[model samples]
Target: MTKLLQWLLGVSLLGAVWALVAFDLLELSLPRTYREVAWPIPLYLLVSFGCYSLATVGYRVATFNDCNEAASELHEQIKEAKEDLRKKGLKM
Candidate 1:
């Protein structure tokens, strides 16, 4: 499946399970400690994911490469365009 749908399904499944346990929807009689722990787990997960995403973006940007040849070629194209424009009686 597409990545968006996959992420949505996974998140929804986790939320359903967390709700079922934290709210004791089935009256399973889980211990107080268990419910207390489950309540904050989603928050912990969200914070950790945020940290991970930040690190990943930082790493990728730090390692990104420069394209000097492409830069020179773009400069040449701009010069050629300017020359053509000048020949066509365009002033700047």
Candidate 2:
């Protein structure tokens, strides 16, 4: 659900950018279009999807921890669980 919301927001942002470009609102010295705007929705979607996928992969890689780190975290959790059980007078 969060992913869906993020995707929607990204596509909306890209659409806004495309609109600004297509209508020459930014005026970045690009060639101006005088005809009615025919926004290529499909192409914009493709570009947005590509960008989102790249960003997601980049974020995962940036925050990823090594296997040893993960194993230690799991070990700590298990130790805590056993201590809690022992306090409850339960044998493990």
Candidate 3:
């Protein structure tokens, strides 16, 4: 159920973004008679949807538990091993 809700949320957010982009395009291309009463709706929606999309990206990034720190630590260990090997004239 949680996964389903998450999927729905993502889909709805993307749909909102698509709607805003479509609205903005139509607003630019269509005649004055075909335009909406409020010109800001698309811009507002676009910004809001953009924020949500960014938030989703942020969430994913946070969940990933990045390995850069671990990699750097391992690299430091390797560097120390190389230094020790050079000091001892040992092949490693």
Candidate 4:
């Protein structure tokens, strides 16, 4: 799950970077309305992305050890419970 989250984060970051680059290129080529807000757009996007990236990294790093252990333990417990139920012929 952590690895999946990490992969998702990486993909999101790539998408953000692509958007930033594409918008920058477009703005450079075409002088659209609200030129005043142009400069701030890239900065805002970068800052927003940086904030989210840092939050995800922080969460992952903090839970790095506990997350994996808990997930495995929970899986084992669930498997055991299922086996017990199956032996008892429970509907679940």
Candidate 5:
């Protein structure tokens, strides 16, 4: 699905940023070690998972707002139609 792809993309981007920062910190704070090479992948995965969760929440919020707006518009149209019918001596 398009939404799945979007979430994957967002997660990848956030994971990349997280990996960069984490690698930089490790490189600066620790001496040369196997962890420097080994840590990034797991770190990326963890960060990506977090990012994906946040993205899903954001997507749901956006979807809910759009649906709410559409419902409001439909209610307004129904009210207008009823008003017009009332003018023509029809009652609901």
Candidate 6:
């Protein structure tokens, strides 16, 4: 399955289970403590996902590679453009 579908399926399953437990819809006779914990579970999941996303972004940025050749080529093009502009009496 696609990543989005997989994620949605997982989330839906978790939410269904959480609803059943938090609301006692199934009459499972779960303890009150369980319900108390289940109430914050969504917030915990959101915070956990946020933390994971931040860590992934930080790791990728830390390991990102620099393109030196492209940088120099861009600099040369800029210089040529500036020269052309100067020739056209566009003082800078």
TM-score for all predictions? 0.65, 0.34, 0.31, 0.34, 0.31, 0.62
lDDT of 1 by residue, 2-92 (tens): 9999999999999999998899899999999889999999999999999999999999999998999999999999999999999999999
Task: Quote the lDDT for 19 in model 5.
Answer: 65
What local lDDT does model 1 show for residue 29?
97
Give the runs in model 4 whose Cα sits over 4 Å from its true position.
1-33, 67-92
The residue pairs found clashing in candidate 4 are none
TM-score of 5: 0.31
Encode model 5's per-residue lDDT on 24-51: one tens digit a residue: 6445554446446646666676799999
TM-score of 6: 0.62
List ranges where model 5 is wrong by over 4 Å. 1-36, 65-92
Which lDDT tens digits does candidate 2 get at residues 26-90? 77656544313435655766899999999999999999876998899999999999999999999
Q: What is candidate 1's TM-score against the reference?
A: 0.65
Kindly indicate the candidate among 2 and 5 with the higher TM-score.
Answer: 2
Q: Which runs of model 6 end up more than 4 angstroms from their true locations? A: 1-5, 67-92
How well does candidate 4 match the true structure in TM-score terms? Answer: 0.34
Q: Over the stretch 10-65, how does candidate 4's per-residue lDDT look in tens digits?
A: 87887676565556645555444445455466678789999999999999998877
**Which ten residues in a row are the worst by lDDT in model 6?**
37-46
14-90 in candidate 6: lDDT tens per residue?
Answer: 99999998999999899999999998999998999999999999999999989999999999999999999999999
In Å, residue 46's CA in model 4 sits off its true spot by: 1.1
Q: After superposition, how far is residue 79 of candidate 1 from its true place, in Å?
A: 15
Each prediction's total of clashing residue pairs, residues at least 3 apart in sequence or on different chains, is 0, 0, 0, 0, 0, 0
Candidate 6 has an lDDT of: 0.96
- Give the higher-lDDT candidate: 2 or 6: 6
lDDT (C-alpha, whole model) for all candidates: 0.96, 0.78, 0.76, 0.76, 0.76, 0.96
